[model samples]
Target chain A: GESVGLHLPTLSVQEGDNSIINCAYSNSASDYFIWYKQESGKGPQFIIDIRSNMDKRQGQRVTVLLNKTVKHLSLQIAATQPGDSAVYFCAEVISGSARQLTFGSGTQLTVLP
Target chain B: SQTIHQWPATLVQPVGSPLSLECTVEGTSNPNLYWYRQAAGRGLQLLFYSVGIGQISSEVPQNLSASRPQDRQFILSSKKLLLSDSGFYLCAWWSDEVYTFGSGTRLTVV
Candidate 1:
């Protein structure tokens, strides 16, 4: 039963502060990972993605870090804002199976004023 | 700009009722289509995927089935709905190593 999981179910961060969310995946064959943000009653929006060959990838105000040694992944949002409050998910694509992505349970991020 | 459309944004159906959810992709052709379900406080679960027309792969054994009648059209159906089937259903298409999801359908089986 290979799966991806998050370390925290919920997170609270002060506005303008940096926020970090962590995830752990059990599949060693995973070659690609993605981070998504989903607001209430909306579809998950792609934030950023990283390949197994690279350890980190950065996007606008966001960064994704991958640790193959420990099968850990993290998403960092700089200058967290009220609009950044949403449920974040981490998904993994296994090698040779690019059509499907195994998703993590997701972490609810709440930005506080 | 490729976009995915899923219809019946919100649906309320009684148990044992028939169900049909349609999804279509625009601005793209022969793209990989997928159906995923997200329960309250849960992650996305892959229900079905189609790489091409008339080709479907089921990820989970459930009371649901999918069909790809056209290159850009994917449909999810069930002869009789169940209470456990209630959730947020999402349709997605793969492009450039990323998945673009539709707004999603909130199905509430009473």
Candidate 2:
């Protein structure tokens, strides 16, 4: 099954610095994309989402960029805080349905002070 | 003010035992409900989804089944437990262009 995957399994960044997590999906039919943050012992929390029609969308201190040309997605967190350290996932859904979401393996972000 | 509620924070069941996990959504109606399972350090795996009462869609074939008797209620059940079934279970609801997830249920089949 073609699914979503992260380029890096783990990432380390200094506090206050920007962090970028990358994802590559193989499903061209995927038109809706979302970013989720999951802390240990908790369910996933939605951060931001972008539709295929748009290339970029920004929310709060987070930004999601989608590139349909390469089937790529990225999440950027500005001024990363200590609490920002967690596993980030990129999920995609095919057209006409937000019911079924395919999630990536996820990237673990570690913020260092 | 939509919220999702899942019962029994944790459970330990022996093999061959029956299992049932329930989830309910408040402050919403006719919402899309989904069931997901996550293993240690793994991504969310979609198990089942329901668009309305008595309408259940299975994503992956396993030892589990889902049912929705009402608009805001979803349930996961299994007749026999498999050790491989031990994992974290989460219920989610999509409504008003927003997605909300319950705290989650930790199941251990020993």
Best by DockQ: 1
Query: Model 1: which residue pairs collide?
Result: none
- What is candidate 2's CA lDDT for residue A49? 95
Can you tell me which runs of candidate 1 are displaced by over 4 Å? none
For each of the candidates, the C-alpha root-mean-square deviation to the true structure, in angstroms, is: 1.0, 1.2
DockQ of each model vs. true complex: 0.74, 0.74
Model 2, A72: alpha-carbon shift in Å?
0.6
How do the residues A27-95 of candidate 1 rate in per-residue lDDT, one tens digit apiece?
Answer: 998888999999999999999999999999999999999999999999999999999999999999877
Determine the C-alpha RMSD for candidate 2 after optimal superposition of all C-alphas: 1.2
TM-score for each predicted model, relative to the true structure: 0.97, 0.96
TM-score of chain B of 1: 0.97
Q: What is the interface RMSD of each candidate, in Å?
A: 1.4, 1.4
Query: B1-110, model 1: which lDDT tens digit per residue?
Result: 78889998999999999999999999988888999999999999999999889999999999999999999999999999999999999999986666799999999999
